[model samples]
Structures are given as C-alpha cells and as structure tokens.
Target: MNAHDRHPMTVPSEKRTAISSLWLWLGGALLVLGIFFRVYNLDYKVFWIDEANTVLRSLGYVSQDVTDTLLTGELFQAEDLQAFQQPSPDRGWDDTMTALRSSAEHTPLYFLLSRLWVQTVGSSIATWRMPAVFFSLLLLPAVFWWGWELFGSKLSAGLATVLVALSPLHVLYAQEARPYSLLALMTALSSATLLWTLRSPTWNRWLLYGFTIVVGLYSQLLFTLVAIAHALYILASELTIYKRFTPNLLRYLIVSLGCIVAFSPWLVLLVNNLAEVQRKTASLGDDRYSIGGLIDRWFRVLNQMLIDRELAGWNFLLLLLAIAALVYLWRQAPRHATWMLLLVGGVPFLALALPDLVLGGERSLRVRYLFPTVLALQLTLGYWFAATIPTKRIPQSIVQTILILFIGLQILSNTVNAQRLVWWNKSRPASTYFEPVSALVNTLPNPLILTESKVSDLLALSYWLRPDITLQAIPDVVTLEIPQGYDPIYLHNGTPETEATLQQQGIRLTPIYPVNDSVDPWLWQLEFPL
Candidate 1:
C-alpha cells in the first residue's frame, strides 16, 4: 500500500479545538433553551386537577375544607372556587402542616416549601409553579455533578447537562405546580452524593449521603424505590470488592439506619394512616390496561423522556437506541458503573412494571414514577456520546449526527407541548376534558354549571371558566335544584343516578361536549319539559 493509504488522515489540533469549542457553545445554547421553555407560558396549560389539589394543600385547606365550603348545595360564582387556591391570613404554616397530616398520601416537604413560596410571592398560577421551575433548574447542575462524579469527565458532565436541559419530560414537570420536579432534583442530587461517598467514604460524605436520603424520602414516597436502588448498589459493590461485609458496608448500613430513624416520624404517620393512603392511591390499582396496552404505554413513557411526539416508527427507533445505549454502557463503562445505573433505573421501573405485568394494573403507567429511570437513561446516552464524539473514527460522525437529531427533536417536541393547553404527561383522567368543555361552556350566554362531581373537579374547572359563570355544587342529585334565569343549565360530569333523577323530574339531558365518547361525558344540557 502507498504511504498515504497506510497512514489515515488526522485532523489538526486547531480543528479539534474548534470542534470542542463548537460543542461547548451548543451545550450552552441548549441549556438556555431549556431554561426558557421551563418558565415560558407557565400558566398556559390547564392548571390540572392535581395542581388544584396542590394549591389547596399549600394554602392549608384539606378535602374536608373544600367539602364544607363549595359542596354545600349553595349557589356560587366560578371565582368562589378559587378562594381555596389563594393564600389567606387565616391559613398559616401550622394550618399547612395540619392539612398535610390529614392528607398523609403526600409528604410535607414540598408543600411546606410551596406554602412559603406562594406566601412570599403572590399566589398567581405562574408563581405557584415557580418552585418547580427553580428545582428543575437546579436539576441541570445536579445532573452535571452526577455525570462528573460517575465518569470523572467534564465532557460526560456537559453532555449529561445538555441532555437533561433539552429533556421534554423534565420541561413538562418543571412547569407543573406539583412536587415531581423536586423529586427529580432530589433523585439527581442523591445519586450524585451516593457516587461521591462511594469514591471517598469520608464521614462528611456519608453524612451528606444520609441527608440526601432523608430529603428524598420527604420529597415523595416513591423515593423509597431510589433508596432501595442505592442500598442494592452499595451492597453489590462491597460484595464484589471485598467478598464479604466490610467497614464500608457497615458505615453505609449505619447511615441508612440513621436516615430511616430521621424519617421515622413520617413513616409512623404513613403507617398509622395506611388505610387513607391506600384509599387515596387505590386508583393506581385500577385494571385499565391489558398487558399489551401496558407494554405500549411503557414504550411511550420511555420515549417521552427525550421526545413526546407520537411518531410510532420514530418512537420504536428511539427505544432501540436506548437499548443499544445500555448495551454500550455495559461493554464500555466499568462494571460498577453499569451496575449502579442498572439498579438505579431498572429496579424502580421493575418494581412498578412487574406488578402491572403480572397482576394487571397501571401503576407503572405513571410518567412521574419513572424519573430515576429517565435520568439513568440520559446519563447512559450522555456517556456514550461523550466517549464516541471526540474520536476520529467513522462512528464518531454517526454519533454526532444522532446527538444533533435527538436534541433537535426534543426542541421541536417541547415547542409543540408549549403551544398546546394539554399534553400527554398531564395524565389526570378527568383534567384533560376541562379545557375543551370550558371553551364550549364559555361560548354560551348565562350558563349555570351544576356539578355533583368531586370537589377537585369544581376547583379545576374554575380556573378555565369565566368568573361571572355560575357554579352550583351539591353533594348529590337528591337536592338538585334547577336555578331560575339561566339560559342553559349544564351538569358537569353527569352520572347515571343524576340522569335518572332528572328523568324522574321530566327533564331530559342532552349530551353537548364529547359527543363521541359516552364514558365520562363532560357537559350535559338540561332539557326541561316545556
């Protein structure tokens, strides 16, 4: 072979420098784009049912308070429902604590922070969501720290930051008023601290890890899955290294026990109110999906971490890419690194997914529950990109192209989500119907909405409705009264019993909105016998 053919062409040092600088600039730009998306149009989407519940809880009002105030068979305006959502002089920090205790399904840390936040800033819709946005912003740095600690490479850290910054799922939760963004922040921070402690094993490092464990548990009940993953990682690591129990393992156990001791009060509360917690979350066990449906949802949620658009072919391609990334991580990364990521991601997912697959439930269908899995996947992809993109091989060009396309798709998906009033992640079953139904109701003159629906439904609908529109909420159809002088009286979320009661009164109900779907009909106009 000729000398030129034998020796492959190499890019000059200046060209390599330029490429690195370009990648750095791109990372910065993606970070800015993410920040902008997080805060942009914060109040644009439907302040969904769960968000309404969040506002009420933060304002120190429980379900009973809502029942007492709004569902008293009284004639009220739409603005009346908003009173519970606002901060008042009467409801203080103590009241918030009381409300949180009553509703033991949620942990108090996020609500307490939100109470302080809305009290400091005015309780506007955008302001209510600001804390989540702030936490999500912090998540970028936490993810960077995690990547740096795990791989000890700035390129990996930067790539991970870029991935998290452009993640559509993160952007969706960040703009929400709920605690999922805080959960994501805690997950990233805890993961990073665990890695740091593993490397150093100092007393302070162990204490820091313990602190994260406490904070994470307080953030959400699902964080227990994260703690389980961390414990498994430490146990597996020590067993692999030392072949038995050692000082490092013992220290980790002590720290873990300390974390549990610190969190015991809340744990006691949860155990005491276990029935209430179970009652509240019973909907999670509802067998809504078949095994095939669950698998479909699994893929969709997995794809949603990066892109939300339902290009079926593209989604499957991304799923394959994720599998390929995991395989690459297993082969190229250290065994411990692969094990840590797998346990962190796989354990939590399998915990939920296995139940759904074996017992037939939709517990694993929740997008918020998969936060750690999303982070692990992102880190894997980030590591793969960082390891490959700097090389001079043909695969380096392919990897670079894939990275650009992936980020570009994320931006496009996020842009689409930003413009709409609803997206896939806003998956509260009844909340999605609020926007369109409200639009229909708003067009009508002198509309009175009579709801026997849940108190949360009333509050959620109020946010979309005009203040002048009348809302009469009764406990049941037994006391249902047809108010005078309303052009058209509508029933929100009409039930069979409601229809039967109206029929007995010789009033036929006409389905207005959601004509195609009979299930959970949104609006029904009362047709009285003339």
Candidate 2:
C-alpha cells in the first residue's frame, strides 16, 4: 500500500480515552496545586496598604448604599478620607464588605460582583480572594483552549495550561483582592474570541470582540495595553492573509472607533481628573530613581509579580533563564518577536515610565504599572513552550518533561519565598484594622474633630456607618467648627498647634480614647454633651 493509504498502528479507543483522561487529571492536579500555593493560609498574612484601602472602600460601597451613591458622584473623591477608618474583621458579611470597599479605586464592575459574592460566601480571606483565584483558575482552561485552536495539538494545549497554572506571577495576583488575575483571564478570553473571529469573521464576532475589549478595559485601565497588542497582532495577521494592508487598515479603524465609543465615559473622567490622578501617582514615592534604579526596580517588581516577594531571591537563577528564554523565542519567530516588542515590553513600559517624565517628572513610579507587561510575559512563555517542542529529534515526553521542570522550579522558588517573606511580616489583613475603625465611629460622639491624617480612615468608615457626626479634616492648623447644640471634641496626637487652634475655636482638646500607639494612633472618643 502507498504511504497515504497505509495507517500507522494505533492504540485501542479505550486506551486513547484513558490517556486523554490522564492528561486532564494531570492538568487539573497542577491547577489545584497552583491554587493551593496561592491561597493556602492567605488570611494568615496582614493586609498591604493598597489592600487595606480596597477593603475599606468595599465595605463603604456595599453596606452604605447612599454613601456609595455619593462617592461615585465624584469618582470616589472620598477615597483618601474613607481610608482613615480602621480595617475590616475579615469575617462575615461585614468583613466581605470592608474588603470590597477598600478596593473601590478601580471600576465598579468587579466590586459590584464582589458585593453579591460577599452577600453569599461571607468575607473570609478565602472568599474575598476567591474571585481572583477563580479567575486565575479560568485562565488555565483558556490557555489550553487557545493552544488547541491555534496549533491543533492537544499536547501543546496541555503544556500551555500547565505552564500558566504553574506560573508564580499568576499565583501572586490570584490570591489578592485586585483585578489583575481577572484582567489576565479576560485577555485570554479576548484572544480566543479574536482567533475564532478570524476563522469566521461574522458581525456578531466583531461585536463580541468589541464587547470583550470594553469589559476588559473597564476591568482595569491596564487592558488598554492588551488592546494595543491585539491591534498590532490583527494588523499583522491581516497583512498575512490579504497580502495587503489598506482594507485591513480601514477595518481596524472601524473596530477601534467602536471601542472608543464604548469606553468614552471612563475616558472623559480620566481626562477631566488628570490633575487629581497625577497627585495620586505621586503618592507612590518612586519618582526620583535613576535609569539604573528604574531597571533594578522593574526587575524587582517583576520578581514579586512572578513569585512571592519572599521567594524572589531564591528564584534568581530561574528568572535569568526565563529572560534568556524570552530572548530565544523572539529570535525564533517574527510573530513572537512582534508580540514581545509591542505587547509585552512596549505598551506597559512606555505608559508607566514615560508618564513620570512627561507629566513633568512629579509623579512616583510604581510596580503595579508593569501589570500588563507581566501578563504579556506569561502569555509569551506559554507560546514559547508550544513553539520550542522538538518533534522528531526529542521525544514528546522529554519536551513535556522539560516544560514541567520549569514550572516545578518556579513553584519551588515561590514556596520557599512564601515561607520566608509572608510569614515574617505577620501582615495584618484589611479586615483586622478596618473593622475596629468602623466600630470606633459608633463609640465616638458627634462634632468629632478627626485629625487630617485620620481623615481617610474616618471617611472610609463614615461611608459605611454614616453616623450622623460632623466630619472635618484637620490640616496642619485648622479651627474646629461645632454646631449650636453639640460640643466639639478635639482628636489630637500631640499636634499642639492643631489642638490649640481647635481650643481657640472653643473645641476641647482631650485624648479620652486612644487605641494604638503614638506614631499612628486610633480614633479618640472625646465626650460631647448635646
């Protein structure tokens, strides 16, 4: 028989099915292991500053409908003030709420959904972090599906899923209250949809792409980087198919215009609040780094993002290898090269870093700026695992083994980091601090003169509690105004000028109730006769 007519010896159907099932089990096991590493004992750690803010705002949003309505009226102007409230308890319904409230700086969609979630699961660390965890979990399936469709190989799909599931960066955000994990999932979904749209190219598909892009962008501003990368890929893909660029250019413009129209509401707010936003950027305290500092900071951020911050040093050898792997892939194919340049490196690096220089070098640079770039790097690595498989020379098992080894190394490094860094900090989760502050509002009297430093905490608490108290931010030296019926109680932590000013205005300076220590004290419950 001719070569085309003859069929190679094949395993029985049941064996093939068993083999397929085994692979699925392996992928599921890897995913479970990844999630466990990220989520196990998650609440044992303390809340980072940003996490505290998110929890405080979230509580304010869900518990205080009116407060959320008011805050949304001005793009969350109460953000700083609201953060003054104490941390949430990380317990039941109230706890879930606080975590969500603290995280309200971004779009409302995720937090809004989180409100519903908290209503059900309650606000344990596991529950609060589950949304991001689940989203990261969704990414594994998405990577598998994308690989299968793009390369028509189940091996490639399974390998990619394993790589993504085992990635340290994916695990890091997966355990947080933030939206980066969701953003990564959305990117995968959008990419998958884009691939399907290319095959079919229907109007519905185009609209689906548009909607997905809008949702992704709304989820996080970093998604704009994802869109930029996709746009370049689409342009290049079209050039490949049509052997020309003009008609594709017009089509891209139409699709892009649609995205702009959909995203205009956010764009308008972003533009109008540019100045206020710049001030927020400055609060990060990273503007003065030299180019060397920037590079060092960039890699350090990447390290924290990929593995746990504690495990960062342990994985230095692997990080160097990962960098080399990226270089190798870029050299291998133009598609990989374009993606790394445009999507992974180009957009996030320029957008975050250039803003400091362009906005007059006033704002501080931050690690979060590299979020999109980090996602792109994860995707690049997945694609690289698919591309570098040696078909004839090396056994397929050997190829899979090598990719799995890389994942194993990353996980090992992260595990070591988690033991060292996360444990040592004994970080206080958002709930612990926020709930007490929220409680203090009920205990304290009206006409409360909250020091300016405490304004953010109080505003966050007031948004949730809405205790009929007169609120004023105590700047360096400011008079406290009391209404006719109520007496004014000055809340001071050794700011004599502030206290004297309040006293001159007929307010009493008394430290009746102090929870924490001197440097950063808690609410002062001074008596006020009605």
Candidate 3:
C-alpha cells in the first residue's frame, strides 16, 4: 500500500470513548446541581392566593359529596350554621369553609389533584405544595434530555440544565402553587418528542408528542402560543431544511390534526367562557411600566432566572460565554437555531407583548412563560459551544480554557443559588387572616362568609374542614341574596375606613386573631348574629 494510503484518517475509539465519558460526567454533575437548587425550598410559600384556590377546589372535588355541597353553597352542617349565628366575636371552621366552598373562581384540574394530595398528606401547607415542587423538579431532567438531543453532547445539555436550575425567575414560580412549572416540563418534552417524531416516523412517539401538547394546552390557555409556534417551526423546517414535501411531514400533519381534534372539547368550553374570563381579566387596570421599565424588570428577571443571584456580578461573564457559543455556531446553526429560537422564544413573547402594547400592560412578564425559550437558547448555545468552537481557527489551549471557564462559572453560580433555595424554603412567612378564619370554622357549622380578599385560600380551608360555606366579595354575595334565609359572616380585609362603613351598618368588628394579628390590616371580623 502507498505511504499516503497507510496514514490513518480516523480518531481512535478509545479517545472517542473518553470524550463521551467526560461529557456524561459533566451532564450528570449539572443535573444533580440543578435538582438540588430547584427542590431546596419547594415547600416554602406554600399557600399563596392562587395556590389556596387550587388546593381548596381540588379538595372539594376529591369528595364527590363535598364537591356537590361546595358547588351548591351548602357545605356546612346545621349545627355549624347555628354556631355561626351566635353572638361570639368568632365562629369556627363552619363559617370559613362554607364561604370558600361556594365562592372560589378558578379552574378545577390542579385543585382536584391537590385535594387528593392533601388527603394523603394531611393538608399542611408544605404537603399541599409538594405536588408543584415535584413537578417543578421534573424540569431539570427535561432540560438535560432536551439539550442533549439538540446538541448531541451531555456537556452542552447539562450546562443548559444548570442555567435553568439556578434562574431566580424559575425559583419564584417553582415556589408557588401554580401549574407553570409543569407546563414548562410538558413543553420541553413535547418539543423534543416532536423533533424526534419528525425525523423518525414512529406512531408511539408521535402519539406521545400529541398527548403532551394536549395536556400542556389544557394546563394553561397560553399554550396556544406554543401550538402556534410549533406550527410555524414545522412549516419553516419543511420549506427550508427538508426541501420537498415528504411522507413524514404528512404523518406529522396527521398527528397534529389528531391532537387538535382531541383538544376540541376544552377549546369549545374556553370559547364559550371567554366573556366571563375576559371580564375578570380586563378589570385589571392599565398600568404600564414604560419600555425602559419593562426592559429593566425583564433584565433582572433574566439575570436571576438564567444566573445565580449571588454571582449576579458574574452575569456578564456568563453572557459573554453564551455569546461566544453563538458566534461559534453561527454558520452551521443559522437555520435550525433560528427556527427553534423563533418557536420557543420569539412567538410567545410577541403574543404576550403585543397585547401589552395595544392595551397597555396587565402583569404579563412571568418567567415560566419563557421557560421553553430559555431551554432552546441553551441548546442552541450548547451546539455552538461543542461543534463550532472546536473546529474554529482558534488555538486548542484557548478553546479548552474558554470552555472550562464557562462551565466553571455556571457551576459556581448554580451552587450558590442552590444554597439560597435551601434558606428560602425553610423560612415560611406567616399569613394573618387565614389561620384565624380557619380556627373560627371549628366553632361554627354552616359558616357562610364573604371576604374582601381573594377566595381561593378560604375555599381550600373549607375543603380541609368540610364546611358548607359561600365565600365571595360583599358585592357579589349581596347581589345573590337567596330567599333560603341565611345571613353571611362578613370579613373585611380593607382599610379602617372601609371597616368603619361596615360597622355603621351594625356589623361588629372584632380584634384580629393572634396567629396573623401582626400582619392583618383589617383588625376585625364582621359578626352577623342570626
């Protein structure tokens, strides 16, 4: 054989294997760090307004009898009702539970699951919020899997996962009793699965993708933006990358069509209920923080969510690395990265931002909304870091040094944030009104009351105490005065000025309970003696 022909042109299997091992270790370390951060204080902030709503309704739904009674505004027993009518400054569980069961306004899916969870865990705030925590934890693995898929390197994927795990914005939502984190996990899985299904025509994968998309959509209406993004991404891919129409595209279309068909029922209900939902949503005032204000707030959000709070000074460092990664992959990744970025980030943001422009702002910059985009950005960045950087004209030592520095910064930032999470979770801030009202329910039977505050927590409390209550805004309850001969136990959460007005109407305002006395502004519960 000629000398030129005898020279080897392939990498040794051992070297390739070593490289694979290195990436695996990098990814694993990142995954562990991410999980630890997200899970540290998951139990803290257990019963925010939204969560209370979810928990209460879920509890009511778990027991068909309770759910029925709750829905009918007759969840309290006769004895509880009589006790609620007594002259005491306080009535127990009866009043609170009855009010909540009858008056809460939110969707039922998450709440129903919450009721089952509370039954299993005794309805403690920590226990009630555990489900959200668990689901939020799943996002790390999803991020890792997603990153690895796009970049074909565990190292790159792990880096993305680390970014997500340490984000302050993500932690904020993860700490709450909401479905945004679950929605994020579903989006990551659905998008990854859709990519795989497109490349390989497997019915099971296609089916799984469809299921994820449907569940995500049902979980939150905003997922319609995701569906729109995916549709656009597919169209772009077909026109640009694939070049010609293929059987796989048709299969994808059919599967997507099937998903749309499955989602029809919920879609119809959403359409029918649009007016009610819109009215409630529109009541929120037009309050814009200006373009500069929006940018500044979003910057802080991005910083906390994409980098560690403690190392925020080093955010610029991390940003440079991300920029380097993108620059490296620019030529090879223009199409795929652009499409993924547009789908995951560009579209939903525009959907959210556009309404703000026309109607001013209405509290729309939630971190979880950008979860899909952040992950995609990581994957695209990772691909750039791994594939393009190594092949560039830069020196080998310089490239190695840059990768090591970037990864090290990410690890340091994530570690600091994980520790922060532990501290935050253990520090549970006490609420003023809920505990007192909950205690009062123990004294009253059919304790029907209305509160100036939101209704979800009260409803959840009723579900826990098994009371027949109808809770609402005073105006709402007054508008529905039933001929059933019942007077409501009113609780005021407004300023002293409003309390004085209620007192003038012969309603007695009692001192706030000790549990939340320090925090309560309305230092009295309105007594309605039957």
Q: State the C-alpha lDDT per candidate.
A: 0.84, 0.57, 0.56
lDDT per residue as tens, model 3, 1-530: 00011111133467657765776786567656656655665554334445554553343322233334333433344234222112232423343344333432233345445555655666555666666667777877887776654544555566566656655555556666677777677777777666666656587877888888887776666667787887787777776655888665687788789878987766666577677666756644367777766765555545544543544455456566656655554545434444665577667777766666667674446555666666666666556555533344567577768656655655665456444423232223324344555666546655445444434333434333444454434433323342344443545455565566666766676754543455654335557445
> Over the full model, what C-alpha lDDT does candidate 1 score relative to the true structure?
0.84
Residue 102 error for model 1, in Å? 2.0
Q: Give each model a TM-score.
A: 0.94, 0.65, 0.68
Clashes of each: 0, 45, 35
lDDT of 1 by residue, 26-74 (tens): 8898899999999999989888888888989888898788788767888
Candidate 2 weakest ten by summed lDDT: 1-10
Backbone clashes in candidate 1 total: 0
Better of 1 and 3 by TM-score: 1
After best superposition, candidate 1 residue 49: deviation in angstroms? 0.4
- Tell me the lDDT of candidate 2: 0.57
Instruction: Give the top-scoring candidate (lDDT).
Output: 1
Q: How far is candidate 1 from the true structure (C-alpha RMSD, Å)?
A: 5.1
Position 130, candidate 3: lDDT: 69
Greater lDDT among 1 and 2 belongs to 1
TM-score of 1: 0.94
